[model samples]
Target chain A: MKSNEVRVARFDGYERVMHWMAALSFLYAALTGLAIWSPVLYWMAALSGGGFVIRGTHPWSGVLFTAVIGWMFARWAKTMGLDADDRVWLTRMDKYATHQHDALPESGKFNAGQKMLFWSQVVTALLLMVSGVVLWFPEWMPRSLRLVAIAMHPLAAIGSIAGIIVHIYMGTMSVPRSMRAMLLGWVTPNWARLHHPKWYREWRGSTNLR
Target chain B: MLVAKLIDTTLCIGCKACEVACQEWNDQEYTLGTFNGSYQTMPDLAPNFWNLIKFNEVQRNGAEAWLMSKYQCMHCADAGCLAACPAPGAITQLANGTVDFVHENCIGCGYCITGCPFDVPKLSPASKKVYKCSLCSDRTAVGLEPACIKTCPTNCLTFGERDEMIRVAEIRTRELKADGFKDAGIYNPAGVGGTNVIYVLNDAKQPEQYGLPKDPIIPWTVQLWKGPLKALGAMVFMGSILGAFFHYVVFGPQQEEAADEVE
Candidate 1:
């Protein structure tokens, strides 16, 4: 919007709030999880008022995270669904890393990589919630099952965290103005046209049909 | 002064007096409850109650059998609870092979609970600290036996040097074997460097029936995830940062929307 006279909406108020809530919950869960998983990261326990609080608070944070992510999935699952173009876009990662947008596929509301992150989060979030619940009150389940869940929770956390790192980089640097779109709920027509031309065409109904 | 205990289950009369003495000695107030089909008062261990007498009533070839096993911390030589403890001075291993918990130092993380192969440590909601059978180090340091051992009426529970206790347990095992109990053996499982407390069980084949693991070892999941996977996670994290840095060095800043490109 600052770059152009016309302001096009990207994220709604509900989407922005949900995103921040998810982000905060994710960060707290990750920190607490790391603090519990190994002693080397035990200093993180101090950040959350010592190891006991971190240990006790982590499962609840995971509950909040799962709830928020569930809501986000309900809202964004359709728009983020992958298609043939998205699959093709996956093959051109070198071009993407090098910033060759001209060689990339025309994207919809979300690009191929964003769609991958969306699906990855969908799976990881569910796995983490299930494993976290089993680990929280392990006595509720059999010891054999609890041991399996204990092994699973950290690996799920690792996966979601790695995806999130790439997502943050993509939003901030790889695709500049994406964070602004999420923050302000709008992007300039120029940004839309250059980054997501097919979406811009759909929104503006412009004469440049190509 | 490293102490150990020998529990002869064959001589145990299934009396809950040791359980009562443990509660009184530790000053842990647990609600008295109705019998839940078995003589055992409580179903499992609690933060307040550091000891338990698990009663298992199983039938063998149409004959009634009663199994009563006293349950408490095993206090291993290679303690996973101590290995997983993040706080310094929270858990200490004595020269006498007594693994002790310092409540003041416990940050109430419950990591010790999961770290334990025996499910011994319990976290209290009130104090937010982990508690377990201390092996009565408070009494042992003053040259007194543990309350449980002292209160055992049949003299089934005895305390002495850890090495001597093992020999006593072996002797009991031989006696049980001669008495027509073919499966008799000492339960000082070597999977965790053997336990400080030894058990001479009549039927050692099914330790699980007495709420004990047949082959207890520190969980492999804890070992790999906390040990090697951690380093790999750090590498992946640092790799991302370095990837970003090198991208900047190679490709420079990404191009934004061009001034001339318009709808």
Candidate 2:
């Protein structure tokens, strides 16, 4: 029989819903964005109804995605703040990559990797929104301004997508227990102890375990 | 045989008939609204707007000049968008050398956003799809000129075989030089593995003068990183699935290894 261990809620119902909403919107925006960027991926139109439909949807959805990310940032900004331990953890990422569990640093609510992801998403979300608006209303601005936005938009998108690819991999596959936190809103005490010892201790002190 | 477009910027009158014709013939929507002094409402290509007429005012030798160019996909032979796309059916090159889009197979990953040098592709927010100029493949299949070329009142845009387009561009360049335009030249013949779209500049301005890259090539780091990273991600996903299956099948969903270690 499984032990009856109490696990504190890291994400409330609203937070969890927002988290998945942002994720789904981001995924959709990323795909449509790629389709418009290359003829090689033009077939993506079939997924969204047709090419014309894809054209109509890409930019508006981008707005929604950006809006949701903004809300998420505001809600989680305080918790995602980095500390000295996080810096040290980031510096030793290779150990984590190689699956050296013992060599990994102890963390609080979020590990160094999670903090890095949080910050990266924040930066990317801002860049995409700003650059997107510039492109949307190019005639209102000077030609030079539009050119700069065009150049920056692609560069920012590339960097963000690369960051997101790693993020999804880590969230879903590399760390088995991480997904459960986002999904069911609970984790085993052993998992909390191993991954986030500080949070585990704090939670244990505040609430009794069965 | 790659089909291409030869655009004579010198002859372009900035009437924007080509822009209108393209939208009407392709059945694309008029997404651009009046903003600047000109009727060319389109600022850039979008999912709905594939072709755009860019108007630039330049001062050359103390003389005022209006530089007009039609912007669209270059349809590069080694298209960065092609290499970067995760979906197999999103983009394809036709047998006649035209880059084609198939919306059915796209997952909208936005990889092509960084892959394109010209920044041609655009996403639609309403339907979550990509859109760009398809060179009027449907029209071209029946040997009809593209809507933009057919509608150019100044006879500025011409479509033909790639080799023939280059020849026309060269002849036009010579004519411009003879007419005392020393900087007249043909653009993008050999760059980016040669582009399907050719341009004829009236003045001595290089391609960069018209907002094009002098030497457009895919970034080496993007190429190097994407292939291995994708492979590693796939491997990890597959490995996890397999590991889960093996554990459930062999150990009947409850492994004794943890218990043995505790003992």
- Please report the candidate that would top lDDT against the real structure: 1
For A1-210, candidate 2 gives per-residue lDDT tens digits of: 132234558778778888898888888887876655445555675798755566457678778888888888888888889888788888887676655656756788988778778788888888888877765553344444544555555566666666776667666555666777898888766667666878878887876443
Tell how far residue B192 is off in model 1, in angstroms. 2.5
lDDT of each: 0.82, 0.72
Q: Which digits, one per residue and each the tens of the lDDT, describe model 1 over residues A39-143? A: 677787789887667667888898998999899999999898878888889999788888887888988878888888888998999999987777776445556
Q: What is the lDDT of residue B146 in candidate 2?
A: 87
Lowest summed lDDT over 10 consecutive residues: which window, candidate 2 chain B? B254-263
Name the candidate that leads on TM-score.
Answer: 1
TM-scores of the candidates are 0.90, 0.58
- Per-residue lDDT of model 2, residues B1-263, tens digit only: 78998888989888888778878988876664658775466566778888888887667789876688888888888787776665666799987778877887665545565567677877776655677888899999999978898988887999998899989999999999999998898887454687888889876456665667777776553454345544553455456556545543543321111111100
| Candidate 1 DockQ vs. native | 0.42
Q: RMSD of candidate 2 to the true fold?
A: 7.8
